[model samples]
Target: MTDTLTDRPRGRQVDPAEFAYADELAFLAAYDEGPRPPGWQLTPRAVVTFIAGSGGTAVELPTKARRKGLPSRLVIGQKFVGDRAVVERCVVTLAGERGLLLVGEPGTAKSMLSELLSAAVCGTSRLVVQGTAGTTEDQLRYGWNYALLLAHGPSPEALVPSPILAAMRNGAVARVEEITRCLPEVQDALVSILSDRSIAVPELSGTTDATVHAVPGFALIATANLRDRGVSEMSAALKRRFNFETVGPIPDLAAEIALVRRQATSALARSSSTFAVDDAVLEVLVTAFRDLRAGRSVEGWDVDRPSTVMSTAEAVAVAVSLGLAATYFPGDRDVLSLVPGHLLGVVRKDDPADGAKLLGYWDGAVRRRAEDGARLWRQLWELRDALTD
Candidate 1:
């Protein structure tokens, strides 16, 4: 029950899930007076509600807890848009103190889901080890403080704890981001940390500090992009330790469009500006993105899928860009006209040859839609030069 908000921060460009949803967390904690795993701040059900939202319902707080200064009723806002069952499974895994691995394509919000779960379960998501090729065992375990080590000589005081080590001690969640990006050996450092729930310090043998035992609620959450499958294939032993969940792209086109609108508007609001991109313009933008990503148009026309991942996250970025252009330039050109160039940019990221694919898409799908007399598609069809090299 660490009040992570004890020291509220100010002027952060992007607030972590813990800080952003501090109120909702507090409400859920008090609202659910059920039994929770030791060291957890909220129950399993509360954690799900905190992530997926309360289905637009306002939960009423118990009178006993209400006197403690919580709201009588509050509507839980949905943070991550996905299956509630997926979130529920993640919560159950963490409740059992098992390592949870969120596997998904790039920009699928795997990291965001990890952060929210960690924040709700342990009251803080600050303990994290960003896995990369350069990440060393010392970063996941413990390293010696050079200055202290020189004076103390293998003493506990000289042992600098890594974020994972700190989490083990505090019984909080330790997040490993892009775990597959780390070398196989570096990644294997976690096997013992998860299985044995302890790290052995050979140098500090014959002392209590020699072995660090994980506290009651310690667990790990690792996120791997599906695209990084070969970068560092997780060892069978390591993979056995985690419950895997695959997060895919938004399934519904309308849901995807609404998500793009919401995220883009929030991003623009950070700068004290409105999302000036029109809804129809957003629809067109999202429609094109969906068609390109799926390799099939809404009307069943075949499209040449680009090598680049046309993720929902990228769509939000493009929407934000459109909003920014409209707000800053003030009608320098139709925002709709900028769609082709922006799409070309997204589709060209992985393969330069994807430019030809985009041009082919315009020649085929854009032409057909324009021929069918859709004004937006006709305008887009006229701007085919934007996709040319």
Candidate 2:
């Protein structure tokens, strides 16, 4: 098994399931005698509980005792808001030793999902390669330290192991973020790493074997943005080496609202600002987001969409501002007044075209809501002048 700790800490080493969601993961892992890949500490069921969270749903935990409180660090929450089946497929793919590529637009939480999965699967998300323009083949393979290579002449000491190499040696999951941002050649370097499941280091002669095969339970999870489509598309051969999973924007309104509310609190807490947005304001804001994002009003009226992507993340920002306003400026004034202003901040992206879309939303959704006897919404409609400027 991989050492779950580094040298610096000398204390009790609790398993991830026990520490993460003690009640949930413990129960799942206890009853979950499912087939586990080699070197994997938890069964696949335990891994799911770690990512999606136990959700207060009852599951039997292991009878083992080591520390106080729940088994795991419940602080790090289950972040992704999507289908559980998608996450299941991802876990299954990794267990099969296949590369899992998460493709999505910006602000879709692809990176976060990848991190959570890595953390749950192997108890650590540190093994990673941030793909960028300057990323090199050696980043995904192995590089040699010039000084050590010059002195010791290509030995293990001189060998600078990349994240992939470290993961291979330790059977940990490795993540490649913004993979399409890397140059085509650099991206192509993963082909051999995914297929052969090993890398050859010809430079480190006589140190060890030229090849380094992956230890059991080792896998690769890479994330790429669809916006990078024109940049450097993954080759057909490389595409074939991995299971492609696309993460779209959050689909459910209530779920999106809950997520926005949670993130808004965090943002306010970060700046020591109190959130002031009322439930009415949040509903309006999220409704606006869903309509604009889908390019149609809730009543099925066609509305022009801005070029800017209206994602759940942006809604959270709007909600945070509203919350801060409520906390700081307590008054009889309804918090719904800030909806138009925040909507401007979210929808008025890209260029003049986005401004036009905002105007269309004001003329359509806002106007229609006012006619439907929504007093709070009518007040917001009256405040539409704030968005125009």
Candidate 3:
């Protein structure tokens, strides 16, 4: 991996290149040949390869490091399951001087993609504003210390620039997570920032006429949840300024399972736990997730739907739990016993109807699959009584 971002800050300011899987991004940059926007590190095609794995292409490393290689943890299996064209559109939009709005249901990886994009482009993904009801116009534009305004008066030091402002000055991508969580007026703060391409500070005397124009590669990537539609829809004025992209759930079951396994395995390894979960049990867990998430079974068995968002993130956690149990307990104790308990944890969020849905899944898919003689699923079927109890 390239050491370009080693000197950057950690925590609140992580070198995007070093965030999680930096080697993949470094590899992408090494062979990248596509056009790069001013101040950007890699081409759009390289950015795409960073997020979507190389499919085992040999990524050469820089020779200077005494270690002569990348950190093992940096090797990650690609997770998103969709057409490459979708990711390409996102990359292209950012390469241009346009705002990219990623709208999706919870757990669709919209926010993750935004982070990866910023890291790949600017070598840092730290500039971010987490939108909430308390998010104000000041949070997006600029705010001042009341003490400073009262004493020394509104000067640049007294004026605390928001993440968006910092990104503008540095020509980096700024992320606004959960944009819909913010109130409508708060969300509208982006309108002028996008269209006018600058933020006017009227608080200062001489600088009242001055506006903060974004640097060449500066861009905004905001994520909103589709389930949050009624909470705060984007105003027409704001929508016009952004290139909107909708990220959907993983399209295929096998792809989803692979993602779950990779994520879960990493987590298990981190805790120093050795998992004994077999392929069959993994299939059962993923099968259940697919059925619940899609509101039906693989073989067309009907299942009741839960109100809780059945995101891939939740599936990964459930798989991790199963692996943990297999690691700690092992053998004849049975991993299926934990399945209902985990399913209940996922389904029993805020609604009682979700319980009914779990029961429906047990009856429709669990019973049928067990009778069809899938041994692992059959074990889970016998343990279905655990959900009710």
Better of 1 and 3 by lDDT: 1
Task: List the candidate 1 regions with Cα displacement exceeding 4 Å.
Answer: 1-10
In model 3, which regions exceed 4 Å deviation? 1-17, 59-79, 328-332
- The lDDT-based order of candidates, best leading, equals 1, 3, 2
RMSD vs true structure, all candidates: 3.9, 5.7, 5.2
Per TM-score, the best of the predicted structures is 1
lDDT of 3 by residue, 268-349 (tens): 8777776567766777787887788888787887778898888888988888889988887777567767878898889888
Can you list the residue pairs that collide in candidate 1?
none
How high is the CA lDDT of each candidate model? 0.91, 0.78, 0.80
Arrange candidates by TM-score, descending: 1, 3, 2
- TM match of model 3 to true structure: 0.88
**Winner on TM-score (2 vs 3):** 3
Report the C-alpha lDDT of model 2 over 1-389, residue by residue, as the tens digit: 34457545343333333254445444444455677888776777767766776675555434553345454333225657888888899889988889999998777889878877777677777789999899999999988889988887777778888999999999999999988889999989899888888898887556566778888878999999888877878888889998999999888888888788877876776666756566667787888888988899878988888887888878887787778778777785567777777777777666655776888888888788898989876887788788767
Tens digit of lDDT per residue, candidate 1, span 208-288? Answer: 889999999999999999989999999999999999998888888787888899999989988888999888889999888
TM-score against native, each model: 0.95, 0.85, 0.88
Top-lDDT candidate index: 1
